[model samples]
Target chain A: MFAHPFLQNAFLAGTFVALAAGLVGWFLVLRAQVFTADVLSHVAFTGALAALAAGLDARIGLFAVTLLVALAMGALGRRARPGDVVIGGVFAWVLGLGVFFLTLYTTVRSGTGNGSAGVTVLFGSIFGLTASRAVGTAVVALVICALLLLLARPLLFASLDENVAAARGVPVRLLGFAFLLLVGGTAAESTQVVGALLILGLLAAPAGAAHRLTTRPLRGLALSAGIAVASVWIGLTASFLVPVLPPSFAILAVASLTYLGAAVGTRLRGTRPTVVER
Target chain B: MTGTFSWNLLADLREMWSLPFMLNAFRAGTIVAVPAALVGWFMVLRRQSFAGHTLAMVGFPGAAAAVWLGIGATVGYLAFGVLAALLFALLPAGRGGGDESSAVGTVQALALASGMLFVALYKGFLNGTSALLFGSFLGITSRQVVLLGVVAAVALTVLALVGRPLLFASVDGDVARAHGVPVRSLGGVFLVLLGVTAAEVGQITGALLVFALLVLPPATVQVLTTRPARGLAASVLLAVVTVWVALFAAYYSPYPLGFWLTTIAFGGFVLAYAGRAVVDRIGRLAVAP
Candidate 1:
């Protein structure tokens, strides 16, 4: 299945991104910060577009923009009851800027004026992966995964019960900002391989699906990571057969299947009826 | 810079009335905003704002994929929208406080990325996908208007029939369930209805502004009233009015309907809040309570 050099790089890149997404996503699901993740991912788009407009590497630009945006969201979410409004406003503005920047870039294409810039910015072709870009994406993903592992316990403590964690002097607000940064980095890394808009699915679905199978936090994290890795493996293999199929679809189709399987397994495992009171 | 009142603006508005398609577009926008505003009120009350956004985003890929396949955009939009709703319904209930948001977010990401990929697969697809994003009310055809009309009618009818029970469920799930309201079933049924509403509105206002319609009315009412029924009634009325104002403005202005609707909805919310603050201060001073 992995005969081509492109396929080899795609598989490696996919694994790193999926693993980081799975880890951070586990906490994201636990904390109910899916909206934050969505906003951060969109921020990455604006950053990438800005990079493209400036004739720079889109990945670095995406990571920088996303980190700053995520930190700002963390600050806002800590202070306000309607923090979501802030996130929503930022999301809209970033999207508007992305569209505007993308339009400007396309209109002023460097005589490759043949429309290649628009394609790269919009769809992000994984099949045409150069070795260097793939390696860079993989390394970034690995770094994100490492950061997630190191902060796993503190992040989980705060996510599960912020009040209790704060009582215990766990630095909950700081941890929240840190977690948001991790989410941003993971989102940026995953976007390189799976594309930006779909990183939320890759991050949240496996973890969300795992949450369905069990309420135990540690077990949930493990299962989330396992499910994510398995999905990357399956998606890589599936994309081989249908070369026309995009990597994002392969990841989605596989992750969705895993979600269904976990749901069914959980239902079947608890068939014993609870005593009902009239 | 084209000044806000530059001759181009005048020319744009004058030429807008000259075209039959522009008239149809205006009619289409009016028809859409009614149901969209009404349904959007319930959407916010039910705390499905983020879910509604996600559903719209997922519709992106469906539309994009359809564009790639040389098919009608509406078919793709509705198809993906319904599929997303079903996915949400089938997931375990009460899994998280943001069950709808989580499911919708996951699906939105997948839909958006996949749409991009499909558009990328074929060359020369940038222009086609642009319409799905920014949208064009000026060049809308008669067929699209009919389709939008049908979608709006079906969504509104379903919403009306289930509105009471859904409202009950939204206000107090436990009490409703205790009274044999089948809260879960109601959620599933309403999600399907919302799926259709979202698809139609998503086409008109883009995914983002749909939230404006959903969130603004309820939020505005909350600033003024504490009674549930009164709040709901006021919310629906406010939504309808905002839609009316936004539609006419979009018709008169050169910008897209979605942009105008968002700005108008936000403005309406601000106005309502400002009025409430003024009234509260005046009443406090007079009554000395």
Candidate 2:
């Protein structure tokens, strides 16, 4: 498994993505912004398309656009913050832009005539990414984790209670925006290996599963990251060994199953899952 | 480039009449717009947007499984979407705290993963798999246009019949329940309606862009006015116009209809948003201390 470069790249990229997804996802769930993360995933798709349309590396567009949009979204609702209705509105518009870019890439790009790039971006082509690109993804994932850690306490405070955190002089708005940026970064990097749609499943499943199992915040976050990493590791190994399962499906199944198992276990044991109710 | 540009814009517009598929596309876009906006309006009002998004995604697996089972993808899309909607209702995100989100997210993840797996496994004739997300343009036929029309008509009729009570329940379920509205039943029915719409829209736009027709127009309209009648009118109008123009653009260009529609819808939302912001500033200035 290690000898194959594609497999190696997939493993490295998957590891980085899983680690960041776990850490960021814990905060994402804590903030009750899973939908926000979903929005960023769409943003990533649009950015990737825009980049491809412009003939630049899609990763650049993916990361930059997602980071900017996530921040902008996080800043919304200060006064008359629009609800899911408004978010749904933005969701539609962004996807339109994504389609526009995808069309341009498919029609105007010089060499890629088959229009398969769009599919690859949506479904992910992680196994085909070069070793260096995979390594770069890993590094970016590390940076995202470090920044998230530095802001964790403040962010957690804000997520728990915006008004209270603001009264205590926390930079709630800025932290909220920063948290989205981290999510954007993680989604973009992970999409390199797992693809856009699959990234969502991988990103949410582990943190959700962890949240269902524990009461301690830090422990939950740790557990979330651990579950994410294990999902990726096991998913990759399964894909490698069986050669029948697609990595994305395998990874999603593993993480979602963890969540499912935990959900059932909590019900069976009748232990109340401890989470802060906002 | 000059030769292609020689036709005046209106001449290009008239050319669509000559193309049957383009006509069908126009018809489908126009017909579906109303129901999508209407149902989407209620979905937003109900704060079931998360569930709505998941429902859109659920169609992917439905379509894929349909292909695996040697059926039309549209059949699968509706089948999967409606089932998921009913399931979400059964699980009821209400009162579960953040657990509601967990359930919805898990459902979406599982649906999509299975869709992927089905696609990977099926050895039969499979086409338009990408259309499950980016949508199929120029693929719209008269048959599809009629199917969409039928679904839209049925869903719209149901929505109208139940509009008053549904609106009450959506805004304040507990109050509506206190007032004798069948809150639980309404939730179930609305999910089913949403599922049908999702499947209908799934045929025109891909799963990924479902919100374009369903959510954006209504969202913009809601912000533009406080009056329900006015908002509903604006939403339907915007939706119809967005798709009509989008279909026209798609017919003339290489881009798919969903993209053009989404972009146009997005542009409309932004314009309305900025306009609202400007009005607010002006009002504030007038009241300045």
> What residue runs in model 2 are displaced by over 4 Å at the alpha carbon?
A79-83, B1-14, B123-127, B287-289
In the predicted model 1, the residue pairs found to clash are none
Write candidate 1's Cα lDDT for A1-278 as tens digits: 56689988888888777888888887777777788788777677778877887778787788899898888777766621125544554465566556555655665655556345534544455666789888988888888888888888877777767788889989878887888888888877776677666677877789878777767777877888888888888877877787677666787778877766765676789842221111
lDDT of 1 by residue, B82-142 (tens): 8888878876676445333556666776677677777768657766666676555656788
Clashing pairs in 2: A77-A81, A124-A195
Q: Pick the candidate with the highest DockQ.
A: 2
Interface DockQ of each model = 0.30, 0.60
What are the per-model numbers of colliding residue pairs?
A: 0, 2
State the local distance difference test value for candidate 1: 0.71
RMSD values, in order shown: 4.7, 2.7
* lDDT (Cα, 0-100) at B76 in candidate 1: 84
Query: What docking tier does model 2 reach?
Result: medium
Query: Model 2, A1-278: lDDT tens per residue?
Result: 69899998888888878999999988777766677677778788889989989989888899889888876776675521225766677777788788778768776884777477776777787678898898999999999989989998888888788899889999887776677778889888877777777777777788888888886789988999999999989988888787768788888888888988988788789895766766
lDDT of 2 by residue, B114-171 (tens): 8878888885323466777767856787777777788789889999999999988988
Residue A154 C-alpha lDDT in model 1: 79
**Chain B TM-score for each model?**
0.85, 0.93
